[model samples]
Target chain A: DVKVTQSSRYLVKRTGEKVFLECVQDMDHENMFWYRQDPGLGLRLIYFSYDVKMKEKGDIPEGYSVSREKKERFSLILESASTNQTSMYLCASSRVLGGNSPLHFGNGTRLTVT
Target chain B: AQTVTQSQPEMSVQEAETVTLSCTYDTSESDYYLFWYKQPPSRQMILVIRQEAYKQQNATENRFSVNFQKAAKSFSLKISDSQLGDAAMYFCAYRKGSGGGADGLTFGKGTHLIIQP
Candidate 1:
C-alpha cells in the first residue's frame, strides 16, 4: 500500500502569518498535488508538481505556492495567511498521469487562521 | 477545460438497499478517465471506482459499480446492499488523457451519502 504523510494533522495560525504545510510520500511517485477543501465547493486544486523543482498553478493558486525539493517531498506555502485561507488542505501522489493511475491521498491538514 | 457536476448535493438511503448517485461532465476530448472518490467523515479520501472512456463495459468493484454513458456524458455510481459504512461524501472527477501538462483531476462539488438504519 502507498502511504502519503502530512506533517501536521491540525494547525492554528494568526492572520498575516506565513504557514508551511509539508507532505511526503513513501512511494516514489512522480506527480504530487495540493488541494483545498471547503463545505460546498468540494476540493479545488491549488498546485501540482509533475517533477522535482517543477510546479504548476491549479484553478485556485492565488496566495499559495509550492516547492518540490525532492522526489518524495512536496511543500505548500501560504505566503500570508488570512481568515479566508483557513481550510482543509489535502496532499495526493500518483505513480504517473496515465491509464488508471489513481491518486493516493494523505490524511488532510486542517488549518485555522484567526 | 473539463467540468464535473454532481447535481445531488445530498442523498439518503436505507441500509441493505441500493442507491445511485448521478454525475455529469462536459469535455471536448474524446479520450479521458472518470473516477468516483469517497471521503469518509473525518477520514482520508479514497478512490471508489474508475472508468475509461474508450471501454464500453462499465467498471465495477465489489458492490460498487458505475453506469457510464458516453453519449450522454453521464457517470453514475450504484451501490448495492449499502451499509452504514457507506455513508460519506462521494465526488466525481475527470482527467484528460495523459500526454503532458498539468494532469490534475477536475472534481465536482461532491454528493454526501447518508445511510439510514
Candidate 2:
C-alpha cells in the first residue's frame, strides 16, 4: 500500500511565525498535493507539484508556498502564521491524473496558531 | 471554476441499514471525474468510490456505490448494510479529465455520517 507521511501530527505556532509542514510519499508518485481541511469548507487545495521543483497555486494559495526539490518529498511553507491559519493540513499523492490513479493521503497535521 | 455542493451537513443511520449522501456539482467542461472520499475521525482520508463521466454505469466498491447522473450533474453515494466503522466525513470531489493530474480536485463541503446503534 502507498503511504504518505507528514512530519508532524500536531503543531502549535505563534502569530507572525514561519511554519514548515513536511510530507514524503513512499510510492514515488508523480503528483503531490497540499490541502487545508476545515469544518465546513472541506479540503481546499493550497498547492500542488507535478514534478520536482515545479509547483502550482491552488484555489487558496495566499500566504502559502510550496517546495518540491525531491521526488519523494513536498513541503508547504506558511510565510507568516496567523490565527486564521489554524486548521488541519493534509498531504496526498497520486500516480497520475486519471481514474486509474487514486489519491492516497497522509494522516493530517493539525496546526494551531496562537 | 467548478463547484461542488453537499447539501446534507449531517446524516444518521442505524447499523446494517442503508444511507445515501447527496452531492451536486456545476461545471462547464464536458469531461471530468467524480469521487467520494471518506475521512474517519483523526485518520487519513481515503477514496471510497469513483466514477468517470463517460461511463454510463455507476461505480461500486464493496458495499459502497455511487449514483452518477451525468445530465443532472449529481453524484450521490449509497452505503448498504452500514457498519459502525462507516461513520466519517464524506467529501465529494471533481477533477477535469485532462491535466494529466496537474490540476487538483475541487471538493464540496463534506457530509458527516453518523452510525446509530
TM-score of each: 0.97, 0.97
Give stretches of model 1 more than 4 Å off: none
How does residue A6 of candidate 1 score in lDDT? 96
* Model 2 Cα lDDT, one tens digit per residue, B2-116: 8999999999999999999999999988889899999999679999999989999999999999999999999999999999999999999998877553564889999999999
For candidate 1, lDDT tens digit of each residue in A1-114?
999999999999999999999999999999999999998898899999989999999889999999999999999999999999999999999998756799999999999999
lDDT of 1 by residue, B1-117 (tens): 788999999999999999999999999888899999999986599999999999999999999999999999999999999999999999999988865767758899999999999
Number of the top candidate by lDDT? 1
DockQ score for model 1, please? Answer: 0.68
Proportion of native contacts in model 1?
0.56
TM-score of 2: 0.97
Chain B TM (all candidates): 0.97, 0.95
Model 2's C-alpha root-mean-square deviation from the true structure amounts to: 1.3
